[model samples]
Target: MTKPLKASGFLGLATMMVVGLYQFTLLAGGNAVPGWMIGGHAHLGVISILAIVMGFAVPVIGVTGRLRTAVTGMFIAGQWGIPGVVWIGEGAELPFLMPTAFLWGICLIVSMLIMLYATLTQDSSGIGGEATGVTPADD
Candidate 1:
């Protein structure tokens, strides 16, 4: 497990806890949520899952060092902030969240492109060390 994966797992757990807290509050006779509050639910569930999925995917792509760091930071922020912006903008009514979210998304895209380029251009496959002219199992 990589540092990023651990972080994402924590975020996923946090997201779940937040959702549970909301439900518990409602069950306890807390005020009913406004329709706009639904964004929080989507963020907590979808965004968190996306981050967790990317966490596992990172290893398969063989990200490491500074590149890993960049990918982790961008992906984590982007995944969470994608929904976070909606919460901040629509839920909290903050106008600035959109720009912040946009920046995070851009960073995430760059990191993804970098990961794709590196993974494609470089043969991180261990097979190169062993035998040549042999294709991958799935291939």
Candidate 2:
């Protein structure tokens, strides 16, 4: 995969791992012995999963053009908005997992932006010159 796609995938995986582990920790009773233990970890997990799937789809499938643009935009919006909503609804007292969630959100947004730029401007090599053989000229 291209650098942007790789970055996006890594960010997505990181988000999923962090949020999933944090939620599992909470579900396994880790929030009880903490001072900044909000239950937003579960929401983070959901967001992370979405990010992971979207990131994977952006690079894996032949979804260039406006479809790719739309997906990347949605991914960015979700990554940032979900955490913002969680933070707002859960108050400012973030737990141990909050930082990871925030980082993941930023990474997702940045990665999606990169992917969007590449998709919009780069040639039809389909990320890293993978050769989809369906260039704009062919269409």
Specify the highest-TM-score model's number.
1
In model 2, which regions exceed 4 Å deviation? Answer: 1-39, 93-139
Stretches of candidate 1 above 4 Å error?
20-32, 127-139
Candidate 2 residues 1-139, lDDT tens each? 2234335545645764676676567778845423222344444555556565665656654566775666566565555555555565345654444455555567557656756665677556555546567767754
RMSD of each: 5.8, 9.7
Per-residue CA lDDT of candidate 1, range 1-139, in tens?
3566557757766876787688668768967765545655665576567667767766667767788887788777777666667677777788766678678679668867877876786666641255667777984
* Model 2 RMSD vs true structure: 9.7
Model 1 lDDT at residue 105: 72
Q: Per-residue error at 84 for model 1, in Å? A: 2.3
